[model samples]
Target: MIQLKHVLVLVFLCVFSGISQSTNGYELWMPYSNIEDSSLTKKYRDYSKSIYFPGSTETLMIAKNELHTGLRKMLGLASIPTNSNRLENTMIIGTKENLNSDIQQSLSKAYVEIGNEGFIIKTVSIKSKTVLVVTANTDIGILYGVYRLLNLMQQHKNLHNINAVDTPKIKLRMLNHWDNLDRTVERGYAGFSLWNWQKLPEFIDQRYIDYARANASVGINAVSLTNVNANALILTPMYLEKVEALARVFRPYGIKIYLTARFSAPIEIGNLETADPLDPKVQQWWVHKADEIYKLIPDFGGFLVKANSEGQPGPQNYGRNHVDGANMLAKALLPHKGNVIWRAFVYSEHDADDRAKQAYSEFVPYDGKFMENVLVQTKNGAIDFQPREPFHPMFGAMPKTPLMMEFQITQEYLGFSTHLVFLPKLFEEVLDADTFRKEENSTVAKVIDGSLHNQKLTGMAGVANIGTDLNWTGHPFAQANWYGFGRLAWDPYLSSETIADEWLRMTFSNDESFLEPMTRMLIKSRETVVNYMNPLGLHHIFDTGHHYGPGPWVSELSRPEWNPTYYHKADSQGIGFDRTPSGSNATEQYAKPLQELWNDPQTIPEEYLLWFHHLPWDYKLKNGATLWDGIALKYQQGVDEVAGMITTWSIMKPFVSKEQHEEVTMLLEIQLKEAKWWRDACLLYFQTFSKKDVPDGVSKPLYSLEYYKSLKFPFAPGIRPQWD
Candidate 1:
């Protein structure tokens, strides 16, 4: 057996080796960076000289261990337990049930406000000395409380008068990993899946603990382990054991494990002749499978399904609609209180009609047809995850359907992992979009949490960007998107600017010298990427398959809908696909006021001008510039913003650690090059149809359109195999 000294050396070696490995961004928000704020360090040291956790439960144990580990790494000292006369100036942690009678009575008022999964941090004078008390209603609550206290210390906030009560607004806050069984993440750029399935159940990685800590710190309550485009093999006995191991690790952190269920699992797992949802044997198969999974993992969050979408098999294959399919699985999981999150991202290669209208048309009629445990998961937009898409038409359209908002934390459309695009602003745009259901502010948030529709069982899913990289999301700044997703998932009402400020304070430096410019850079980052990549409602312009770089000229895919040109419909007459009455009449899907507003380009927001209507090259924009000039200027503005981000990050070099500062500096350079690439490639291609000179003050394309079009990336990553 290895001695204690040997164990210490092994741990040191492992941590150092992990850090030295190439900067893939797998570390995420759990950087565990040594705390830098001098005043804050002293405050934490004074209040946490010793900790006495009264509870002796598994959750309380986890809370104590995590607090000890985090403090040692972050504050350079571990908490010592005290027994004799309550140690003054020390941190006290416990559930209400475990606290001493007198202490419990005093903390009762605070506990009432804390609620379940809520906590309170207060500095009280005990026998003429100040002691910080961290109390919660439950052990899991204390775990969250401990993390919250640490976060305050890390951010260098004054712990003198801390009183915060936070309860998640949504019932389910989750990360939906598009990670495959073989560990290849769909649309994932950082690296292979963080889950090493082959080594799991035998060897539990420390990374799993770190992942749990990162999530719990941000109040993310659940994680789906597999891709919605799932593998049936994940449900077999072999994989169940692997999943149980993960569940064991995550359980203490208040995160429940969920799996993606392949819709045709009956046929795939049970050697059944058919997977028709109504079939008795098929129903029995799912019931047994859910039972098997629950037996292995008691607190399992149910399945996330991607049925009848993009050629995935479903009950639709047997002529049954989504409601027919979802209800069947919902019934199977009802006994275990598990849910069925059926995705509404369905489209067809054969639909000559507008893609935006497909989901709304298929599901609106079946609004109240689902099971009580079923939730129809809808993406932010109707089409794929575009850089900028209007809110999906189904938001207020489904009054009876419990529609959960699905946002992508991964930057699949916004330049993958290389570009520094903060997505809170993007989320803010969609969340605040006036669905015009009944009133002016009938927002998407209201529809998602069952508030506007007056239903129950609220949920929200973010397609995860996590991978096996050191920094988590590839780019250091990209971690903000993940952080923002969880915060917004917890409270959808929080503004994008607010989330940016919090993330900047937590991830980077809290000094205003560093915060002001970095916050500005983050707030504008998403729009900068949008301007450079797909301006004026232009969508799906990236190359086919890999989806990297420009491919506006791509019109040779197997299906017309799969081609970039099919979405843009750019021609000599004008650019942009007209979804107006004269075109596909797709705007009819919106409610009265929006349908009217979007029907005319003159009334629409400038940010979404080209999305609704097709305009001539010289059409006058709201900004007093012609459409062509406006488009060119927007692209140039994007390139300039990226340049500004570079300058902003350079200013932060002194505030941030050299290791992190240098990594961001290098990534910004890559972003600048790619921003210009997007600009040149797009302008060169679009200039062909406009038959005009490059707009004044806008630099001419550095290369010929033919040269830009000739750029090929046959070896680009994230390409899904046709056979798979």
Candidate 2:
């Protein structure tokens, strides 16, 4: 009996060990691993000797708990509470009003600069004793400061004599989750939606709390908890209670909940005759609905509307315009200080001219017509989220209107989370592009941040990539995209390199060996995707509907703009859409210098060469290679880069955890395979037009053109669920 019991105990121990060995990546960048360096751990313990935080509110308690949790995990010492009012070397944290008089006087200058949402952390001498103080104008600010302090500790940076005052450049930074009511996430590759609507408002999952914590740490202020393809049922009483419960959970973390407002909700939910913005009954219904939502959740953010686009209902259905649809809702939300985010990603089937010019033509004419509370959210590129495209002309064109930036954090068009593509590089390129609207330094970032036009309300929205996956993002490196989006939304001027370094240190390790190579790989990952999939200003050539892989030959869609053949006007003579003055004149939408620069093929940047001006197959590129040769070489270069990334990660086994290292290694192998697949498929299709041989350095595809085109993906993940 004793021998049998020993054998069973050994088997149980083996199973337990196996479970612990698998790192699920749930902790994200806030792993809070114990500090291995004895010297740094001792220093952190010394700084966090005692806590002087004083507040009974949930937000304050959250701040206190986070500081304690992070400190204990990192330094193995919980902060002792201080009984006396006099300050020593204890860490002090609270709002400016809640802090004691002596602490307030010392931080008055810092407080004057930071606005309501900004925070300040500094070391000060109080009563001849050194104390570190984190003070802000509000409890949310205090919470932000706490996260900042903890992040610094996680990076193993010294906290002594620290003085930092930070404020968000934009007024609102939000994450738009494309999650459906049934827990299905559109374009979400991680797993099912984090929201369990079936069990919500009663059985709140711990995931919701962790979600709030992660967003709070990154300074994301708002979350739209539904798909932009809005449904009317979410507005009904059955769902409002569930949304309210989520709001209650996220409120303490400074995250306000917003919902996508279905344009026909009046007809669907209120049983009205028509959903017209001009109809008095429709207007009254919206006012009552807004009032009802506010009663349940007083701090509700607002509505995100996708109107008259992609067959969604809008004021256009009722012989009205976008301003009419947006203003009607704005008036109802005006009393609650809520704003309406009307998307500018519109294109009509009738407009057979360049689809790229449709949004600017529709919105620019009515620049100043929008209400004060309405913001026009424009995508980074005019044409869908292609791997590469020029900045949207709408950025600087709508000077009188407040245009917010909409960046897709999910890899819908790029590779759907299976391929590791760092999107911040793509975002930074768009933000840093010069618009030349007002002056030389007039960048797209300046336009969206309200500095160029001196606009009051400014905001940035990222379509979130979070889900129920053990790792918040499917790929380990994909989390950096979410982190990068928040950091850029907070400060548009920050470089991608800076963000990558910060994330690498916090998420993986501070070891220079791991940080150096991984940072290089991340910085170049997006461009590698662009090179393989759509080099030289190519746009929207993905497969129809799901957009999983390449389909440059697809042209069967009913609408002209819906087909890949419409965007890439490839023929026997040459390739690319001619958007120049001789063609569609889409360059005229940009400001003066850009219009002149893009009209001529010689003056346009090589990256945007084919986008504006279609040229002959034998045209010479800037690198002295023929256009066909350059295109082929770019495809090969992309595949080579992926191979290099795999090799780079292979040597990083010593620095990363075994589970993380193995997961990334397998993902990188998948990425390399997909990269080759993209290169072979696109080159074969375009080769028919060029009628040229593959370049010297380019590797010839193993499969025939027919073989490449015959590939199908009927069971790809993240496809939009068709509802009856």
Candidate 3:
């Protein structure tokens, strides 16, 4: 066995290696850089000298360890614990149950405010002695409190007389991993899957623990381990043992493990004849499966199901509807206190009508029919995840159902992980959208948080951007999107700008010179991608299969809904699919006021102009430019914004490490190239129908339209793995 001294040397070498290449981002906003300000350092170190963090429970142990690590790295304070009976000048951290009886009695009122998961940190006089108390109702809450305490210091906030109480607004803050069993993640641009199935059960990776720390830092309570396009083999006993190992690792961080259940598992794995919900054998198989999983992992969250979407099998494969399919699984997991997140991303064989309207038309009639444990998971937009989409009409319409918001954290349509697109601004936009369901200010945020219709179960799931990349997310700035998603999931009302500021301070530096322009660029990055890729309400114009770049002229595909030309319908007459009464009548699915507002082109928001109506090339925009000229200018503007980003990052070299600055500088160059590619490719294709010259301010296409069309990428990352 290795001696204790040998262990110390090995650990020091590993940490030093990570520290030496600090700009590699392996630490991910937790580098714990030393305080440059002497006053702040002294103040932080003075309070942290005598930490009375008691209790040896797993969660409490991790909290103590994190406190030690943070203090040592941030303030060079190696000796953190002061095991003493006295409370004066000590920072006491524990669950309310473990605290002194007198102190617990005095803090009963504060405990009531924290509920089960919330925590409180207060500096108060105990027996005429000053002590800082960090207490919560449960051990998990204490762990969360400990992370919050460290994060405050990381953000360069002075911790004098700090009194803070926080509780998550959304009950189930979750990540829906699109990872597969074979380690090929669908739409995963960072790297392959994190779960090493070949070496699981006994060999737990340190990345698992670090992943939990990052999630707990921002209060993410749940994660679905497998892909939504799930595999039935995961339900087998061999896989449950591996899953149990992961659950044990995550339990200390207050996270529960969730799995994605394939809809046809009964037939696929159970040797059953059918997977019909009404079949007794199929229902019994699911019940037994849930019981088996629960026995292995008692605190398993539940299953996320993708039924009847994208050629994936579902209850619709039988004659049954979504309600029939979801209720069956919900009943099975009800005894275990687990949930069933039924996806509302479905389409039918009737591809002639609008694909965006199929899900709403199919499920809206069965409102309030689902079991209490069942939540209808809907994506942010009606169509697939686009650069900028209007809030799905399904929200607020199903008043009695618990609708969980599903936002894609992965930059699937926003230029993958290559572009630095901050997604919290996109999430905030959808949350703040007015649904006009009952009265004024019936925002989508209120609907999901249970305040609007008073729902009992609420959740927000982000399609994870995580992978095995060194920084977790592919781009260093892409990590902000993941961080922002968690923060927004914790509190739907948080401003994207505030999230940007905190992320910047923690990830890089606290200097205002770096923070101000960086924050501005981060917030505007989403719109910049939107302008270059799919400007003015255009959606789903990406190329076939890989969806890497533009394919607005793609009309030869077998399925109408699969082709970009189906949505745009560009011709000599006009462009854009008219969703108003004159065409597909898709706008009528929304509430009365939104229906009235979106029907007319003039009354609609200009950003979503082409989403609802088509117009002639000569049509004038509110900016006093022709429709053709406006489209050309918007595309040009997007390319210019990317150039500006490159310039902004060029000057940021002084603030960040050379490696850090150069990495982003290189990515910015790639982003600028792609932005120009999007602009040129789209304008050239659309120009075919408009029969017009490139507008004045827009740059001339470097290649002919045929050359742009000829470009092909057979090996783009993030494509779904093809199976025999």
TM-score on alpha carbons, each prediction: 0.93, 0.96, 0.96
Q: State how far residue 90 of model 2 sits from its true place (Å).
A: 2.8
- 716 in model 2: Cα distance from truth in Å? 1.1
Best by lDDT: 3
lDDT per residue, candidate 2, 1-724, as tens digits?
Answer: 5698898886665333322222577887787766778899877776677777888789989988888888877775654555445355467777887677877887788888888889999888777667788889999899999999999988888878999999889888999999988888999989989989888899999999998999899899999999988988989999999999999999999999989999999999999989999999999999999999999999998899999988789999999999999999999999999999999999998777788999999999999999999999999998988888899999989889999999999999989888989899999999999999999989999998999999999999999899999898898888999999999999999999989998988887788888899999999999999888888877788888799788999999888888999888888888888998899999998988998888888889988988887888888988898888888889899999999999999998777767788999999898888888888888899888888889888888888889877888887877875432
Q: What TM-score does model 3 achieve against the real structure?
A: 0.96
Cα deviation in Å at residue 67, candidate 3?
A: 1.1
Can you rank all candidates by lDDT, best first?
3, 2, 1
Task: Give the TM-score comparing model 2 with the true structure, all chains together.
Answer: 0.96
- Candidate 2 wrong stretches, greater than 4 Å: 1-22, 78-83, 98-103, 721-724
Model 3, 602-682: lDDT tens digits are: 889988989898888889899899899999999999999999999999998767877788889889999999999999999
Worst 10 residues of 2 by lDDT: 13-22
Candidate 3 weakest ten by summed lDDT: 13-22
Write candidate 1's Cα lDDT for 469-559 as tens digits.
7777887777888889988887898998888887776665567887788788888888899888889888889988888887888999887
Model 3 error, position 496 (Å): 0.3
